[model samples]
Each structure stands twice: as C-alpha cells, then as structure tokens.
Target: MRVALFTTCLADTLYPNTLRATVRLLERLGCEVAFPEEQTCCGQMHYNTGYREHARSLARRHNEVFHGYQAVIAPSGSCVGMVSELYPGLAGTPAPTYELTEFLVDVLEVTDVGAYFPHRVTYHPTCHSLRMLGVGTRPHQLLAAVRGLDLIPLPESESCCGFGGTFALKNADTSTAMLADKMRQVLGTGAEVVSAGDNSCLMHIGGGLSRLHSGVRPVHLAEILASTEEDPWLPETR
Candidate 1:
C-alpha cells in the first residue's frame, strides 16, 4: 500500500528518530511509505488556541500536501485527531488520515511487526488517541506481541498527562499539578520507559521525569514497535 508519513512538527523538530522508526516499521510491513516535504503542522496548535482562520489556512495547506496518498499516516495521535476530527469542521475536506497504530492494526491487519524490545515498558494513552480517536486496545495489542517485552498496565491509564498543547503554557500551575500526579504513577509502576503515541505529551512527561532524575524516560510508541532483535533499539539512547 502507498502511504505518506505525516511526521508532526514536534517529531520533525525534536524527535527525528521517531519519524525514522515509523518509516522503517512501515517498510518492514511491506508498505511503500513516502515523506511529503510539503507537509507541515496539521494546524493543531492554531486550532486548539482559538485561531480559526490561521488554523483553517494551515489545514488547507495540509490537505493539499497530503492529497494523493492512498493512506496518510501520522506518528502523532493528536495531529491525526486534529486532521480527522477537527479538519472537517474547517474549510476544505481533509484526506483520510490514520494514526500509525490504527493504520497498522485496522488497515494492515498486522500487530506483530517483528518487534523486539526487552524492557518494562508502560504505555500512556494520549487524550486524542484514547478519547478523541478512540484507539483503544490497538496499541496494547501491538505491544503484547513484541518478543521479550514486558508491557505493564499504567495505573489510571486513562488520566490525562496534562500536556494539552497550549493548555500547558496557559495554565502552568494546573499542568504541573497534573504532571506531578502522572510522574508519581509512572514511578510507582517501576517502568523503565513510558511510551505514548503523542510526542507532545511525552515531552511534558519526560521533562518532569528528568527533573526528578528518575532515570525513567519517555519513548514514542513507533520507536518501540519498530525495534527488532537483529537490529535492536537501545532504550537508553532512544
């Protein structure tokens, strides 16, 4: 299948390896993945911040850039949810967009993509993926099949990590409080790494973990899913 990788702005700017891992994972699954250099922000930051016209303009650009692909796949659930859920309410019609796990599990119908990562990994379901997109169980289902990987249940898995994009910046106090609770729970689980679909959320959680010097780090779900025994991804470096 022909697919376009919609590497979100955060991934492109901060986590390039996550995007690379996504491409590698799709190629491993026999998908012809293409990266449209024209693709930019999905206008999520503008939209969520009440800049309707600005968001609409970027949304139009997003539609144009991802126009012809059979499937436009994104590593971020927030960006995909922004395109899939919010774009329709904007001006132009958006191309059908799928979050990476959804495209892998629902469209490709494959969970075990030959991934191998030996670590006590816990998944944090981002708000857009869990609440907005309703991508329940697909992520866990994929992680369950990874060889030598110990997937643990995150306590109160549905609770938000308080990284609501602009929400974090606007309400710093509330955001930090919510992050404190999330960090406590993450530490309680004794997980070596916390995995989530959205880098925005991971960035928030990861920063807090770093402050505490907890050694627990945040990893994108794509990075973990792309790993294999032969060419293993060292979680410490990732």
Candidate 2:
C-alpha cells in the first residue's frame, strides 16, 4: 500500500528519528511511504487555543497537502486526533488519517513487525491516542510480539503526562504536578525506557526525567517497533 507520512510538527522538529523509524517500519511491512514536504502544523495549537478560523485554514491546507494518499499515518496521536476528530467540522471533509499504532494493528493487520529490542520498556497511552483515537492494546500487542523486548506495564498508564499542548504553559503548576506523578510511576516500573505514541508527551515527560537526572529514556513506539537485530536502533544521547 502507498502511504503518506504526516510528520507532525513536534516529530519533524525535535524527533526526526521517530519519523524515520515510522517510514522504515512501514517499508519493512511492504508499504511505499511518501513524505509530503508541503505538510505543516496540524493547527492543533490554534484550535485548542480557541483560534478556530486559523485552525480551519490549516485544516484545509492539510486536506490539500495529503489529498491523494491511500492512507495518512502520523507518529503523534495528538495531531492525528486533531485531524480526524476536529477536521470534519473545521474543514468540509477530513483526510483519512490514522495514528501509528492504529494503522499498524488495524490497517496492516500484523502485530509482529520483525522487531527486536531487549530492554525493559513501559508504554504510556497519551490522552489523544487513548481517549480520542481509542488505540487501546494495539501498542501492547505489537510490543508483545517483538523478539526480545520486555514490555513492562506502566502504573497508571492512562494518566495524562500534563502536556496538553498549551496546557503545560497555561497551567504550569498543575502540569508540573501531574508530570511529577507520571515520572514517579514511570520510575516505579523499573523500565529502562518509557515509550509512547506522541513525542509531545514524551518531550514533557522526558524533560522532567532529565531534570531529575533519572536514566529512564523516553522512546517513541515507532522507534521501538522499527528496531531489528540487523539494524538495531541505538539510543541517542539525551
């Protein structure tokens, strides 16, 4: 199948490897992936911040940029949620979009993508992916099928990491408190890595973990699923 990669703004700017891994994973599964260069922010910030007109403009742009693809996949669930859930009202018709895990399990119909990651990893279901996209257990199913990955269950896996885009900035104290709780649970899992579908949430959690000097690494689900013995994903310096 031919797919268009919707590299969300956070992944494009801060987590390029996640996008690369997503492409690699899809290709390994016999998909032809294309990156539409004209794609930009999904205007989720504007929409969530009460700028409906600006959000609608970008929504129309998104429809135009990714018009002809068979499937549109993004690494971040937050952005996908914006497009799939809100675009219908903002733009006339919404593009067919799926989060990475959603596309992998539902569209591809394969849990074992021939990956191998021999580390204790826990998954955090971001608010958008969980509530908005309802990608329950798909990520877990994929991680379980990996060759050597030890998928640890995160305590309170569904709790928000306190990075609801502008929510972190506007409610700094509440966000930090929630993040502290999240970090504590992640640390309690004794997992070397904490994985999630959204880099924005990872960035928020990773920032707190870094400040605490905790060694728990925040990895994207695509990066983990993209790993194989032939070309193992080496952790970048945090």
lDDT of all predictions: 0.91, 0.93
Report the Cα lDDT for candidate 1: 0.91
Estimate, for each residue in 1-238, the C-alpha lDDT of model 1 and write its tens digit.
9899998999999899899999999999999999888877888888877888999999989998989889999899999999998888896668779999999999999989999999999999999999999999999999999998999899998999998999998999999999999999999999999999999999999999999999998999999999998888865454
lDDT, candidate 2, 95-132, per-residue tens? 68999999989999999999999999999999999999
**TM-scores for all predictions:** 0.97, 0.98
Q: Which structure among the candidates has the greatest lDDT?
A: 2
How displaced is residue 79 in candidate 1, in Å?
Answer: 0.4
Candidate 1 deviant stretches above 4 angstroms: 235-238
Q: What is the lDDT of residue 192 in candidate 1?
A: 96
In model 2, what lDDT does residue 78 have?
93
Poorest 10 consecutive residues by lDDT, candidate 2: 87-96
